[model samples]
Target chain A: MRDQNRQFRLAKRPEGKPDHDTFDLVETDVPDPGPGEALVRTRYLSVDPYMRGRMSAGESYADPWEVGDPLRGGVVGEVVESNGAGFEAGDIVTGDLQWADYATAPGTALRAVDPDLGPVSTALGVLGMPGRTAYFGVREVAEPGPSDTFVVTGAAGAVGSVAGQIASLAGARVVGFAGSAEKVAFLEDELGFDAGIDYSATDDYGAALDEAAPDGVDAYFDNVGGPITDAVFDRLNVDARVAVCGQISLYNATERPTGPRKLPGLVSKRARVEGFLVGDFAPRFEAATERLAEWVASGDLQYRETVTEGLESAPDAFLGLFEGENVGKQLVRVSEPDE
Target chain B: MRDQNRQFRLAKRPEGKPDHDTFDLVETDVPDPGPGEALVRTRYLSVDPYMRGRMSAGESYADPWEVGDPLRGGVVGEVVESNGAGFEAGDIVTGDLQWADYATAPGTALRAVDPDLGPVSTALGVLGMPGRTAYFGVREVAEPGPSDTFVVTGAAGAVGSVAGQIASLAGARVVGFAGSAEKVAFLEDELGFDAGIDYSATDDYGAALDEAAPDGVDAYFDNVGGPITDAVFDRLNVDARVAVCGQISLYNATERPTGPRKLPGLVSKRARVEGFLVGDFAPRFEAATERLAEWVASGDLQYRETVTEGLESAPDAFLGLFEGENVGKQLVRVSEPDE
Candidate 1:
């Protein structure tokens, strides 16, 4: 009960790729819960591409992470102590529990993580925030249908991987963009992408996209919006929709860099490109989580977790998302099996 | 039996700005109508900006004009004779008729022009296709409400003038961009535009747009897709919708020119910029035209026509749209107008 809590605090902002100096592992006391609060022992800490934006001192669509503060993200954990009436001890939960060994919330931040559906770790991947993101970005923005050819960028990662499968399930002809031949093959062979284009292999990305989507693309799920996006813009059908979920490729630039050839393609194609935050649809969380769990259980939806063991390994796992290291959902498994 | 026919033909294609050499007028014998055809005496002719695209050789969104051929456009006229059973002589009609004093068309193409709607020539401008184009571009594409701040480019031309007014009527605070001070004032004074920006005045177009629309633009009705539009693009609000109705500024452009440097702003703001041709909404013409007529009759809408008298002057009227010569709708009163 008196185990020391190890916390990774931000040391300095990274210029491009984060180094070990950017993070500090410090020992902190496990504090008691006050009125209407609960202490949580994190089971899994989710590492996402969006976390890269928070590291910058510059303006982001979301708030920037302050230096010297603990890095925070969505985590699936167990509540060890509670003063809130509804959520008691031993309940599995998911919320914005920071990158420390344990966290305390006002019970308002944490939600019950359903264990029967699949794994509790899925709360950080398919059946939680990322799932809600895929839903809103696809259903609300892209609105892919059976006749539509849906194209997804960053198709091997947490959100993009889920978005591609969901579009396919909605009867769309889905094509994915991944970094390597292996990931491209994985997307097509295992994940059921209609086609896959390895962006890292080709200089003529436009032609590669053309080959993959022989028919014109109706909607584009743009997780990476640079040249990959400009190429996709050129291939868009009339009245296309682009859901801009992230721009990971540009997030860590040391300076404001020049981007790919764009605009004329955007206007000529008559497309709609919109940016969104998952928090915009927070009201629909319960309904979305329920449906996401059902799909995962029925095997209609697929999810995978790239788990890094131990709380001390959390920083490297997060930095790995920027380098495209993880295969699917990246999470740090914080604690060993409970007796 | 002896009413001779005459047609003004497109003798040569214009390089940049079309000149008088591009046209050739001649008298020819009238051809007899076959089954499903009727003889239409051209009374009023339409000379629109889009007609410029038709004059080119190839690779346009619209069909090109044939060499040494009598040009055809939206015409309001009288049915002189008919091989088709549906029409009778002296029935006033409007349709795609040749740029001539006398022309023939399928009876199906001819709609009996309502003479009682103010002046019959109104059929060529505010009461017809041009009017419907403004309607759909503003309502369906921009969809600006009272709370919206609307910005328009080429804001004193046929479609642009109507678009600004419609946006104002929708309770939007309207700002217009015009080539001259006179046209700018006209948009502000007569059309109820809150402000008018003379784009020719300075290089600070984005600043000018910002000055005109302090709250930032909610909807942009873009007819000119060059720098003027780029200026408007720089001032869009979050989730803003831009209806790219026409790209007249780029029509005769020798090379693809770029400026108005604020595209990436669209991503963060989640704005939508899309190109549209009025032909895409041809199916809804009847509904759109009827509403436009009612709006015009009730004085809720206003129209202006830069009429060039006689069929011989149609070329000058057509070329004037590009030079910013016309204040609003440009038309050629091809005959006595059947008065």
Candidate 2:
């Protein structure tokens, strides 16, 4: 066992885009598991866009991470030691944990990861929170019917990719907006999306949509909000549904960004725009996970990952999301799991 | 009966706010009723905000009124003659009719006005399109619960006044934004709204909302969208719902207006913003109108109207909606009902 554990702490709140100064890495003694707790050795650290909200002092769905406190996020780890907890040593688990090499968590908070389903790192990605988010968002919020045009922004990212594929599987014509030609190819070629637009390559998204989504957008899963959203609002068909999953583009803004008023357009279309959080569907998570696992195993739903080498790369990995650097799930490999 | 009917025709599409130049008063012979048609003498003509959309060449929910075509709107009138139609002569009815002293429409298009319900003018006011808009918007869309802070803009206008009253009746604590101190009193004293803010009297709407909706807004019904909507978006609580019924404030803008992007705030609040047209609920409008009539008959729902004297005043009555000159449903009393 390692004698010391390394953890990342919030150094300060970011004004706009976070920089290296926003995080502080510190070495500490390996945490001991308390009664009904297990010491976990983190193998893969998930660097998600939602974590950006925690870096700010403002109110959000998730509580803000205070400065000087250990940063926390989704982690796939192996149980190092169990102190009267249900799990045994060497068991793979996933839960919300500290951004550290070793940390302690209550047994009830952790779920065992099945390696046979896929790579255990998927416990932090495809078969996890992002997958559930996409599952519910497509089926429940933005319910794209057969022959409906489903348009998704940030289409090559973990959640957006999954969301687009899910909508396609539901028999909807899927159109995606990704950052690059390569990512757009992945969406159209690999994921069976009907069409893919490299949003970064075009200035007029409305014109692109005119060619790609000629029927107009019936169901929209928005991850990157800004000009893309404005363009989507313009093309919304009557009775259209928009699921607001994330606004990664506006997350780092120092001041509130303004755009053409959308509510007026909504009245003409009778469209519905709703924002949702995955945690709100906790009771249905297990069933959603099973369905997602089946899709992953059947090769029906494909995914990708941009894994950085060490825990030190976590902040850079996270910041890459806002820059559209990562193709899919962004993760930091802290250490290898014991056989 | 008048042999010559004076009708208002669209002269040309207005650049911004329509004026006398937008309408050309012309005299025409009263048309004879055809098969399944009835000739009706217009009594009260409804001058609504939505008409502005029809005046433009741009696409909207309603078809644009072409230049040189007679302007049409909701009108309550006394049937002069029937040709194989359901109504008898002198029977009061309401339907979309031209801005003339007399017009002919198919029997299927006209609904008999039960004079015993209230004043016949109400067929175009409280018991008409605006009232039904408020009904579905409040009961189905906004859906305020007991103790919920329900905020509404244009609270003294046609749809908004009824919306606040209905929400208040549903047990929500209602806060209203009106244009004048008298309108504020009308909302608070006569209508039973918990609080009312004279929006024209205050430069800071956020501060006004802070005082009126101290618990934060749970449900919002927006009628006059613009800066007031921006302020309401700022004070939304978790799980808020915004029903976009109208954007009268933006109807006159020559250019598409821009405001703070609201989708990001929606994510944190897990909120919903939906825009709707009353016509979308056509299948259920009868039931809704019946319920609204019951509320009115029971004195649970109170309504007021600002009536202009003649057909010549129709254009002025509609232009007044943009200026916030009318306290309630603005209408033009073309003539009195036949004895």
Error of 1 at B123 (Å): 2.1
Can you give the DockQ of every candidate in the order shown? Answer: 0.28, 0.90
Q: After best superposition, candidate 1 residue A122: deviation in angstroms?
A: 1.0
* DockQ measured for candidate 1: 0.28
- Best-fitting candidate, scored by lDDT: 2
- Give the TM-score comparing model 2 with the true structure, all chains together: 0.99
Point out where model 2 deviates above 4 Å.
none
Please report, as a residue range, the 10-residue window in candidate 2 chain A with the lowest summed lDDT. Answer: A330-339
Chain B TM-scores across candidates: 0.94, 0.99
Model 2 C-alpha RMSD vs. true structure (Å) is: 1.1
Instruction: List the global CA lDDT of all models.
Output: 0.81, 0.94
Docking class of 1: acceptable
Error of 1 at B285 (Å): 2.8
